[model samples]
Target chain A: MRALVARGLPVDFTWCEGEARARALSEATGAVGRRLDLTDRAALQGFLRAVVDEGAPDVVLHCAAVSQARGLQDLTDDDWDRAVEVNGRSAFALCRALGPAMGARGGGDIVLVGALDRGQTLPLPVHFAATQGMLSAMTMALGKALGPVGVRVNMVALGPLGEGLSRALPASLVEDYRAFSALRRLGTAEEVARVLAWLALENTFMTGRVVTANGGI
Target chain B: MTGRLEGTRCLVTGGSRGLGRELCLAFAREGARVAFTFRRREADAEDTTLRLRALGCEPQCFQGDVADGAHAQAVVGALTRAWGGLDVLVNNAGVQHVVPLALLEEPDWDLMLNTCLKGPYLFSRAALRGMIRARKGTILNVGVFSSERIVEAPAHYAAAKAGLRGLTDALAREVGRHGVRVNMLSPGLLDVGLGRMLMPHRVEEYRAQAALGRTGTAEEVARMAVFLVSDENTFMTGARVTPDGGL
Candidate 1:
């Protein structure tokens, strides 16, 4: 983020989890932050417009979702709807609202973050599967539509990188996962964030695509 | 499993149908958390999801128009929030218009380029941040054989694919030293139903171009996607692998 800000790219570390967190981040980074729900359509539009009004964002780092790990049979309509709208609809709103301005300005970059399982499975993760999959397709489609207008689109397919989920799992379960990895270890959040910065700065020509950052494990 | 893509989280564009679907399944089976996309084809996405679930993967899906920028940003944001970061991104989503050169719709060119080239650019831009922060990542774009030989496909489709190939090289050149690997995969004459639909009559003709006796399969292409995206692919960037059965 400092690197980007140094390069004249406006960096707003958006924090929608809660008001306190958003405020803390805003103060800490001197960047705007938001505390809103992912499912709120109107608010999404307003947030984007606000972003543009402030400085017409060159890139949007999407880092939000509603998720569950239960089986398909356990998922309810609320779960399904929430995931789709939050994961899929919310992203579209950003593009629809902010993309044209970026295009008109001539060559703006917008990268979308896609999850690890749009193509994989995780204990019956049907809801996330649908939402993540569409997110990528949507990115590709927009790549086609926005390319002419001068907006670049891309996606990042992410893997697991934290310790909370691991700590929460049973002892044997961790080993079960470890056995399948090439490095037999978990990844970290910082690692993922580093990759994000490089793509933002260096890989300008590549658009409408995805990048993987899993450790050998 | 302990597959080549073990411990990886890969997102595959256009993953619900044709070669994209196979790439999804193969990634999951290989122990990567695979994320994939489907355009207007929810059933195909569902089918792929159901099968991927059986493989012990944690697959998820997102809905939006890839041709729209707002949606593209949202997708990336959601993934980061949910997974805390991204590992790999595969730009496999694309479209082809069968119209003759004179009959091509203006929007058709946009659609092809958006899905094939522009979308990858979006993902690359967004994912690069996370990858650079981590100091390691992989970017893979799916290319068509027509990228090199443009005359075979429709004008717009071929042109868009050609641009994508160029973008692949450009990305490799720009970010090879950042511990980020970017590459391209070009598959020819896949054996999927869509492959047949894309050119049913030319199946024999397609097979004849490659040294292999028959056309390719989604699984074969998926294998390449896994390699380019796996931990074994640390040093490769802006490289293109033509997985066209020696074509």
Candidate 2:
């Protein structure tokens, strides 16, 4: 959000539950922030409607993701459903809600933030990997469905943000993940955000594509 | 002020002219001890070295064909020995042919595959030896955007570039555990390199296709190369990045 604003794009952001942090970010950056539960279909619909009613945004970027890193033996069906609903399903809902209006208006862009799921030499939870795979497939499908109308759909697959993950995992483990990138470091949110903004604003012919921003991972 | 890559040791293949020349200068400007290989362009390589010296850095020049596995190894070996360890490797040596698939000869096929695909593989494998030992290094292979999508390059050229994607991914997975990373930089048609001399028509066509409606500058592409190999880009491996201004 800060990066997008810094790029001189007006950004309106949302969080699932972090109202305080979201509010502070919005206040600091002059971006509107809304606290909404995207996992709830009714709430998601309402939020999308409100956003559309206010005036359709040129770009709707979905970066909200939920991950539950549990062993296969310890995972539950509910956990799987939650992961899908949050990461994959919610994005589908958001696009469905936005696509038609954007199509009617003749064009817009939708970007989903995805993960470098399988091949990056990193450990991924079964649920998280499945959700990301779904998102990847959906991104392509959405691009094809929306392309004729000038709406572009794309995904930016990020590897690992070492500094952001360091708060939860050991710094050494974070470094271990960082070593997997050709850059030999973890990516910054700002860097990934810049790519997202580029796809939304600069990239015209790119659609149904997954751009990797994982320092080459 | 210190540059971002201060004290870093860097080497670029085919650094005598075109995008390779810009990459050599960019790395040198960033405070890296830069060296490069030029297959047969002694004058061009010497000119590049003189320019680097003017930038207050001594740049080393080598003559070798990166397509030759033995030559690739020798270049890496000499550089590793001289610098005590290799820090960054940019596989920028490549040849582009525009003939149709139906007309591409066997020799053209061989040349494309050897220079574009096998060159990066051999150079990366050779560089990985010292990098894995030091437990740190970055490798960027210069690739064409056609490798990712269908563009009107010859069958051999497209196939070779696509093969480079495979090489980058496999090498990244293989050496990543050793603290080495490998990636590819796939650029769209630029106004420099063989594009200027061989494909002026295609360059104009690509400019029309690009989102920005202009072909990219070599320096713009070089900036992305520098970032991908620098400390700032830590979490990207087996990744293919394009700085084509959106084609």
Query: For each candidate, what is the lDDT?
Result: 0.68, 0.78
Question: After superposition, which runs of candidate 2 have C-alpha atoms over 4 Å from their true positions?
Answer: A1-13, A20-34, A37-61, A67-111, A116-154, A159-209, A213-217, B197-201
User: Under CAPRI classification, how is model 1 graded?
Assistant: incorrect
- For residue B246, model 1's alpha carbon misses the true position, in angstroms, by 3.1
How do the residues A78-188 of candidate 1 rate in per-residue lDDT, one tens digit apiece?
989998988789888888877887776665767776665243354426787788788888876776667666566767766554542235444554565455433344556
Candidate 1 residue lDDT tens string, B75-142: 77777887777788888888855677788777887787787778888878877888888877788888
Per-residue lDDT of model 2, residues A1-217, tens digit only: 7767876888888887767878789879999887877678888889989988887778889988877546789889998988899899899988888887787787888989988534455556778788888998897788767766667788889867743422444456567766544556666787777667656765554567677877655
TM-score, chain B, each candidate: 0.93, 0.95
List runs of model 1 lying over 4 Å from the truth.
A1-217
Instruction: Evaluate residue B197 in candidate 2 and report its C-alpha lDDT on the 0 to 100 scale.
Output: 57
Please report, as a residue range, the 10-residue window in candidate 1 chain B with the lowest summed lDDT: B238-247
Tens digits of per-residue lDDT for model 2 on B202-242? 77887666544566778777866776787655556787766
